[model samples]
Target: MTESTPALPQRPWRQRYHVAAIGWTLLLAVLLVLSSLMTGANFGTFLSNIDQFLALLVQMSHPAWSYLHVILQPLYETIQMAVLGTTIGAVLAVPFALLAASNLVGNRLLRGLIRFFLDLVRTLPDLLLAAIFVAIFGIGSTAGVITLAIFSFGMVSKLFYEVIETIDMGPLEALKSVGATKVTIIWYAVLPQILNQFVSYFLYTLEINVRASTVLGYLGAGGIGVYLQRSLGEFNYSATAVIILATLVVVLVIDGISNHLRRVLL
Candidate 1:
C-alpha cells in the first residue's frame, strides 16, 4: 500500500484584515473632510470662542441659593411626571413587545406590521410629541406626562422585544412541552431571564424622561424646563447653575439606583 502524505496546515486569514483596515481608514478620512466642509467647521473658530465660553462659565460659578426653595415645587412636579410616565409606558410596552417579538409571535407579517408601527411611533421627536400633546391637553403636567409615557412606550417596547429575542430558547421550549399557556410561559420562563434587563432599561428610560420633561416645559407642557427657559432668557446664570446642579444630582441618583438594581438582579 502507498504511504499517505499528511495534509499541510491551512494559512491564517490575515491579508483580508489589512485590506479592510486600509479601506476603513480611507472612508473615515473622506467622511471627516466632507463633514468639515459641509458645516464650515474649523479649529480657528473654536479657539476664538473658547475665551467667551470661559467668561460665561465664570458668571455661572456663583449659584443663587435663594432660588432653590422656589424651584422645589416644579422640580417635584418633574419627578412626578417622569415616574408616572415611565410606569404607564412600561405597562403599555408589555403587550406591544410580545406582539413584536419574532420568537413569541409566530406570524412574520404581524411581527413586521407591529415593528413598523413601533418605528413610526419612535420616529416622532419627543419635543414635537410634547408640543402636540400640550396643544391638545392645554398645557400643565398632563401634556408632559402623556408625551413622556408615549416616548417611553416606544423606547421600552423596542428594548423589551430585543431582550426577548436574546433569551435562551430552552426554557421556552420546556414550558411549551408542559402545555403551559402563553401568558404563563412568559411569566414563568421568559420574564425571569429578561426581568433584570427590562428593569434596567426602564430606569434608563426614566432618566431620559426626566431630562426630556425638563425640555417639555419649554413648550409649556409643565416641568423644571419652564424655569430653565426663563432663567436663560433673563440671563440669570446663577439660577441656571443651580438648576444644572439639581438636574445633575437627579441623574446621578437615578444612575446609582439603576446600577444597584442591575447588580442585585444579575
Candidate 2:
C-alpha cells in the first residue's frame, strides 16, 4: 500500500491576518456610510433633479453651426495663446529642471530650494493667476499667455526633473571620467537619452495649455471663453454648444498631432 500524506495545517497568523482584513474592511464601510451622511449626499435628490438635467442636455444637443463662422477668429487666438505660452514655459523650464535633478545637482540644498519654488508656483490656481495677470496686463491675450506660461513652467519642470532622475547614470559617469565640464556632460550625455521624453512631455503640456486657455478667456484674458460666458449669460445654449464643439475640435487636433510626434520620436 502506498503511504498517505497528512494535510498541512493552516497557520494561526494567516487566520489572524484574514480576520484583521475583514475588520478593517468593515471599518472602512462604516466610515464611508458616516461620511456620506455628514456630507448630505442624497441619491433621492439627484434622482428628482434628473429631468431638469436632461432638459438642459436636450437644449445643448443641437449645436449652432452658424455661430462657428463668428468664433473662428477667437478660436485661432486661443490656439495662439496656448502655443506661445507652452513654448516660453518649456524653454524656461530646461535649466531649472536640470538644477532640480538630484543626480545632476550634487547640492541637496539647492535642489530642495528649486523644488520648493516649483511647489509654490504649482500651488497658485490658474484662474487666480489669470485674474492677476489681467489686472496687470489689462485684459488681453498677453495676460492669458503669461498665465499659461507660468502654469506650464511649474508642471513641466516637475515632469522634466522626474524624467532626468530616471535616466541611466552610466552615460553621466562616462562623461565625467573624460574630464568634461558640467554643461558639456549634460549636453552630450544627458540630452540624447532624455530628448525624446522631453519632447513628449512638452507636447503633453501644450495640449493641456490649449484646454486651459479657453477658461482663461473668462477672466477677460482673451479667447473663445469670453463668447462662451456671453452665450451662457444670454441663455443662448445653441451658441454655447457651438463654442464647446469648436474647443473640442481644437483639443482633438492637438491630441492627434501629439500622438503622431510621439510615434515619430520613439
Candidate 3:
C-alpha cells in the first residue's frame, strides 16, 4: 500500500494579517519620521519647556478661593446659555433628523441632501461659529447662545438620525399596515423607541455646551471663558487655577447627572 501523503495544514488567515501589518507598520514609521522632519517637532524643545511648565504649575497650586464668589454670576450665565442653546438645538434637530433618516423619509435624494448639509454644518468649528456670531450679534450671551445652538444642532442631528436608523422596524411596519397617518405613526411608533436615546443625547450635548460656552466667552460670546482668557492673559495663574477647578467640578456634576438619567432611561 502506497503511504498516504500527509495533508498540508492550511495557514491561518491571521498569519497573512501579521505580514500585512508589518509592512503597514514600517510605512507608518517612515511617514511619521517624514512628518516630524517637515513640522520641526523637536523633542528637545519640549524637554526644555518642562521646567517652565512646572513653575507655572507650582504657582497655580494654591487656587484663589476668593475669586469663586466673584465668578458666580458668570457661572450662572454659562449654565443658562447651555440650557437655552441645547433646548433650541434639540428642538430644531428633531425635524431635521426625522427628514434626514433614510428609514423615516424614504426619499433617497432628500435624505442625502440633508445629511450632506448636516455634515457641512458640523465641519465648521464651534470657535469659528462663535467668532462669526460675536461679529454679527456684537458680543454677549446672545452670540454664544446662537453659536451653541448651531453647534448642538449639527451634533444632535447626526446622533438622532443614527438612533432613528437603529430602531426596531417591526413597530413602524405594524403602524403602517394599520393605515396610520404619518404623524400618528411617528407619534405612536417611532417616538417611543427613540425618545430615551433623544433625551440621553440631549443631556450629553448640554454637558458639552456648558464647557464650550466657557471658551466662547473668550471670543466675546459671553461666559466664564472671558474671565478665563483675561486671567491667563494677565498671567494670573492662581485665578486661572480656580476657574479650572470650578469648571472641573461642574463637568463632574453634569456627568453624574447624565449617568443617572441614562440608567433610568435604559
Estimate the TM-score of every prediction.
Answer: 0.81, 0.85, 0.90
Clashes of each: 0, 0, 0
TM-score of 2: 0.85
Q: After superposition, how far is residue 65 of candidate 3 from its true place, in Å?
A: 1.1
Residue range 1-266, candidate 1, lDDT tens digits: 99889888765666646777888999999999999999999999989999988887887998998999888899889989999999999999989998999888999999999999999999999999988999999978999999999999999999999999998999989999989999999999999998888988898898888888877888888889889889989989999999888878877887788778777876
Global local distance difference test of model 1: 0.90
Q: All models: lDDT?
A: 0.90, 0.93, 0.92
Candidate numbers, best lDDT first, in rank order: 2, 3, 1
Q: Tell me the spans in candidate 2 whose CA falls farther than 4 Å from its real position.
A: 1-39
Model 3 per-residue lDDT at 87: 92
Give one digit per residue, the lDDT tens place, for model 3 in 1-266: 89999999978887957978898999999999999999999999989899998989997998999999988888889889999999999999999999998888978999999999999999999999999999999989999999999999999999999999998989989989989999998899999999999999999999999888878999999989889989999999999999989988887887899889988987
**Candidate 1: where are CA atoms >4 Å away?**
1-30, 42-51, 168-181, 184-189
Q: What TM-score, to 2 decimals, does candidate 1 have?
A: 0.81
List RMSD in Å for every model shown. Answer: 4.4, 3.5, 2.5
**Model 3 TM-score relative to the real fold:** 0.90
Q: How displaced is residue 116 in candidate 1, in Å?
A: 2.0
Rank the models by TM-score, top first: 3, 2, 1
